[model samples]
Target: MSKPNVLLIGTGGVGTIVAYGIDYAGKSSLSVVVRRDYPKVKDQGWEINSCNYGTIKGWKPAAVYESVSAAGEAGVTYDYVVISTKSLPDIVKPEVLAEPVITPGKTVVVLVQNGFDLGRPFIEKYPENVCLSGVSHIGSHNHNGVISHIQTDKAVISVFENPHLDKDFQVEKAKEFISLYSNDKNDVSYFEDTKWYRYRKLVYNATLNTVCALTGVDTGRLDLSGTLESVSIPAMREVVKIAKADGVELPEDVINTVVHSDDGDWFEPSMRVDVKKGNPIELEVILGNLLRVARELKVDTPVLSLLYELLKAVQFRLKEGQGLITVPEKRPISTKYYS
Candidate 1:
């Protein structure tokens, strides 16, 4: 039997682990799509220090392309197209981002990004394809070409409910993916339904991620500053409420479980890291979409709404810095606001 062909779209912290796990499994031939670091990565490869895989000096995929189109043009129909990019629907739609490599009825679209309803656009766009939505619980980073994996990878993967594909077929596809993705130390579990799982994770992401970014604190300091109890937990409750209203019944102790899921270590969440680096944080898919759901479902989210509004201002500044949008000086000027 021939090895399955996999195309990875992102090479960030999470993407590195996704590639490593798949490659470590040695069950599939993995290719990657890198935007700017293709030349360096192709030549020098990566220095990976992982908790699960120990220390790998230099590592690179079977092939690295400049873009998804380039990878697609290679004429190999990918068995799995794993996307681990930031979920910024306002910047780029999920369907549009993955459209270039999709093989209609043959390819399985695996979304390993954050945010709610991550697979909806893919299912709508490619009705013939199976979409496996996964929630990654790992702490890792890619600094330059050196990849550091601090936490062991624990992923929960589930097949999105697709009316076009048979239920049994979806399960088989998900199992095949799990087999190709799981290794000795890294744990990957398959679930029948992941909507509840996504919501459960939002209890962590939508709260700690936004709060820590806005407040400029790591998880430990945030907890030490009494924000975890007074602010983080309250925000988490709001997410649970919204989930229940959206017909996803999370456990009563879900918030507590998420709060203590990790030790109160001095580490920044991904959103906070993005904010500190002057990169645009994932606002829309992370909180904006959830807020929209709250509004439709009539679930009140004062904490999340306030965070969203504040983050919108931060996003505006980020956009200005990135030259995505220009702020007109004539519109309004307030030096005191910065102070």
Candidate 2:
């Protein structure tokens, strides 16, 4: 089979990284879409560096469009749409989302976003087009326009499941991505009920991201044995509890699996980084969604509830004059630290 064409959206870490991955495949036709302000990235010519792959330079796309609308204006379509752009419903804007180069057999939108619900935004717009839920644990970031693959987790692509996934087509698409990512160490696991998996992953992320943001620790540092036993482990178990309560089946070994996996610590997540950069941390994404789901399922998240309360307190402190969300734990040597 011929290598399918892929158009990657989002210009942040994953966008650049996915560009590099597709380039490495050396088979797919790859195009990247960034915002108009970020058009300079096109001039730089993309490159990716990974501990696993060492350094790979020279990833010039067939073309780079400023926005999806621009790409649409130019009449560009792909067999696969890899949406790695984070900060969605904000970054991509409403106008460009689900605007199709997407049609059955014409395009399969592989929604590779974080924080779950890959099908949420798309189902409304392109009910007939395939929206396959996918997540990437690959830790690569654009450093001075260079894509660096620091680590990778299990990359999952969804079955069309919601509206457009014919079983045979889903299987074929899975194989295609498996072959695409096969060159790299990570494998593309396919799940039929992508939402539950996505939500389960969301619960996992709820802890990982909020704690990382609240404590201001890189995931890599905190996942160490002591932190794992203390903070990370307990937090994750809370997430697992929510998943089970909601009838989501999370593997017993997922935390172990993620930590031990190749790209285990892909550096600080976007929210933590946002906090450091003096931007609003993504408390809404991690906490809001999980809270909404918890309400829907009527699941108790006492530990998560505590985390949520603390996270809001921190956010309020940051905006309500202090302008910062401090670490989750109390200071090491303050009177309030212990008491």
Candidate 3:
């Protein structure tokens, strides 16, 4: 059998780590889709200082495309297109981003993003194509084109097939991508219920990410300051209630599991990091969508709601400060939320 041809989009920390795994597996031919950092990455290559995989220096991809359109112009029908982009639907819809490269019946679109409902657009747009949802538990960061990853424990990836196509074909495709990262340092598991796992992961992100970003602290500091009990735990409990209302039976100890997970105390979540860097955060997918579901189900999420509002303020401040978005001037007596 020939090696699978894969196109990995968004070469950030997660994307770079996944790309390294695929390269290590040697089972797939890898290409990347990058934007502003394209020239730097393509020229300088990738230098990964990893805890689990050791040092990976000067690694270049088989091909690099500036955009999905450029990749499409290459005329290659990829077997798998792995998306590790931030799930910011407000910025760009997932369907539109993947449109240029996805071959409806042939390509498997794997989503390695945070939050819920991220794969909906892709599955809806290409019902014939298999879509896989993956929840990643890896600690990594990218700075000045270099990636530093600290795998405190084995990074776990739980992948499940979306309800769109043949289950068998989807499972087979999911396993093919799983094989690319199932080494001694990484563990990959398959699940039948995608929503359950997505909600489960949200329990961690919805609480820790939100609280950390709001307080401008790291996981360790939050825990040390007793915010884990005063804030994080309550927020996670709200997530549990929301998940239960959504018909997903998360374990009763799910909050405990998330709170006690060995995320290095100093480790900053992607959202907090983005806030610190003045980059757009994945506020909607992580908290906004969950809050919407909570409101629809009439599930009380006062803590989550408050965190959502505060995080949104922080996001607005950062975006405006960075000049990514403009803040409208307000009249002295304006009563509206935005003016």
Candidate 4:
């Protein structure tokens, strides 16, 4: 049997890891869609220093495109389109971003992004297509086009099929995609409850990621400064309550695990790194959408609400400073949320 033709979008730190995993599996033909870094990655390939896979030098996909449009123009329908981009719904709708490459009933779109409800748009757009949601607990970073993965713990990837589509074919497709990440060093598991897993991972991301970004500190510093107990723990508890209100029963010790979990001391979450680098952060999906659900369910989330506001401000400032957006001098602002 021939290998599957896979198109991997978003070549960030996590994207690089996913690409490498697929390449290491050697069971698929991989094509990548990149933005600004397209030229560099296409020219020199990727230099990865991974603790799990060791060092990989000059790794290139089977093909590279600047955008989904270019890939679509190439007239190739991918078997699987794995999106490993940040969940910045405020900037671009997920459906719109994936529009060019998605072949409604033919392609399976797997979302490997952070935050919740990211798969909804794609699911809504292509009910016939298989949609898979994934949560990653991998530690890696990209510096100067070189990815450095810290293997302090086994990289855990939990994936699940969309509950809306209760079909055996969808489940099989999810399993097939999950198998791409199955190696001795990585732990990739398939679960029935994608929402529960998303909220469970949110317990870690909504707290650690938000606090670290706000304080401009690393996870180690946050833990050492007692902020994990005072701030991070409370924030995670709020997430639990919100999750419960949304009808997901998280583990009882989920808060404790998030607060005390050991992924390494100096690990810097994607949000913190994005803020420091003045790039757009995944504020809406991680915290903003969670807060919206809390409000809809009448659940109190003061800690999360505060984090959402602060992070929004930080995102606005960073975007403005980077000249990514223009700020009106005296325009009337609306209180409506991005969602």
Candidate 5:
């Protein structure tokens, strides 16, 4: 199997995990982009903590670029570019991020992040066929440059028609990716139902993440038996309703299936991680999206609206104590959520 040259744009937990997965696959060459002080970031090689790879030794990437422009200028090319940036609005913009991060090689770009709209900007930037939409179930915190893998369920994905894949074997590429994560912990799988998978994930994040963000509780601590029944379960069904209204074909009970099992407890969500790290909350990433969808579909979501309000309220209270606006904490909501 010929290896593909890979360029990863972000160096957060997800980026580190993907780098490990790609290296293990032995079917992809990997490079990860760090910030201005490449020397500083590179000084500390990646320490990945996964059951599959244990507290393994650090592995440096084939190439490291401080910026995409520098990598492009340096004549480094890639067959695929995986974007794992978390904060969408700041990192991804029209002017700063409009340039194609991937070169005109055998490059097929995949966007790995939370939220359905996370890849919307990429889809807008590139032709649909050239882009692949994906979601990772791994959880981690950047514990002093080390990626501590909290939990990993599956790598779920739905392929969009990205123009770049024409030069490559699409199934071959996906299988290569899936094989990389065929460990006991995380399994990568591809589904043809891109829209459904997308919405289904939205259901998972909106329920798991939004509630966690509001309550400031990790999935490990919460008693979700009741949440799975009344709050989370109903909210998930409501999300499906909004999706169907907006023409997203999702399964009947994907939420109940993927989220609430008879497990003892769960893991910390990215939203909660963002809060704990004192980074701006991803309210838009989890809630504002469906709000937009509700507007488009004219769906009513009272429970979601209340959740939004409470999330905003908590964020406001926290930011007030911190003496800053606190990273998009302005809930700025009302009963406007139509489904």
Candidate 6:
């Protein structure tokens, strides 16, 4: 039997480890779409230092393409097209990226990005294709072409439940992906209700990821600064309430667990990293969408609301810096109070 062909888009911290996992699983031949770092990755390859796979020097996927269109033009129908890009709907849509390579009913579109309801666009766009939602709990970062895997390596994948597709068939394909993505080094399991898992992840992202980005604080400093008790826990509790209002009942202990999950580590969450790097954070998918649910359900999220407003200000500056938006010049006004 021939190995399954897998194509991964986005080679960030999370994407790099996922690429490594697919390669390490050995059941699939991996291909990657490299954008900015195409020349470096295509020529010199990646250097991955994983806690699970140890040190793998000069690692490259089975194939590499410069763009999704280029990968689509290759004439190879991939079994899975894993999207690990940041979920920034304000910037780009996931379906736009996956549509080029998707083979309608054949290819399974797997979303490994963060944020709630991340698979909806893909499901709507590729109704004939199986859409799977993946929630990964891994601590990894990519600096240049070198990857550093620090903490946990566990992932849960489940079908997004598209009415247009067969449920049983989706389950089988999800299992196949698990088989190809799991090994002794890392853990990948099948989840029945992945949205619940995504909401559970929100307990961490909505609170720590958002707060740290605003305060410029890392996980370890958050504990020492007393913000963990004053702000973090309250924000997490609100997320839990919002999740319940949206029909997902996360455990009461989730807040405590997510709080101490990074007990002694001085790690910066993804959002904070983006802020430091002057990159547009995943504001919409991470907090914006979740807050929308809260509003419709009449769930009060003062902490999250305030955080969102502050972060929106930050995102405005980032967008302006990246030239995604242009700011009009200020106009002179005469007012008695101004004197």
Best by lDDT: 6
User: How much lDDT does each candidate structure score?
Assistant: 0.88, 0.65, 0.81, 0.81, 0.67, 0.88
lDDT of 3 by residue, 217-261 (tens): 988899999997899998888888888898999998888788778
Cα lDDT tens digits for candidate 1, 1-339: 899999999888889888989998999999999876778788888788998998987688898898988998998889999999888777778689788888899999999998887777788889999999888889898888788899989998898878888999998999999999998989999988778887877898999999998999998899899998888889998999999898899988887787777685687888998888888888887898789889999999999999999999998887778888886778885567553
Model 5: per-residue Cα lDDT at residue 226: 53
List TM-score per model, in order.
0.90, 0.72, 0.86, 0.87, 0.75, 0.89
TM-score of candidate 5 to 2 decimals: 0.75
Instruction: For residue 9, give model 2's deviation from the true position in Å.
Output: 0.6
The stretch of ten residues in a row with the least summed lDDT in candidate 5 is: 89-98
- The order of the candidates by lDDT, greatest first, is 6, 1, 4, 3, 5, 2
lDDT of 6 by residue, 231-263 (tens): 988999899898888889998788878988887
lDDT of 4 by residue, 1-339 (tens): 878889988887788888888877787888889886888888998899988888888889889999889988887878999888877888877778888888878888888888876766777788778888876667787777889888522333433455566567777787888787666667777777778878888998899999999999988899889997888888988888988888999988877777667666688877888889888899988888788788889999888888889888898887788787797799978999896
Candidate 6, which segments miss by more than 4 Å at Cα? Answer: 219-230, 265-267, 329-339
What tens-digit string does per-residue lDDT give for candidate 5 at 86-189?
75452245214525455443466777766665555555555433566667777665666767876764577556544544524655565555665355445778
Error of 2 at 312 (Å): 5.6
Identify the leading candidate in terms of TM-score: 1
Once model 4 is optimally superposed onto the true structure by TM-score, how far is the C-alpha of residue 295 displaced, in angstroms?
2.6
Model 2 accuracy (lDDT, Cα): 0.65
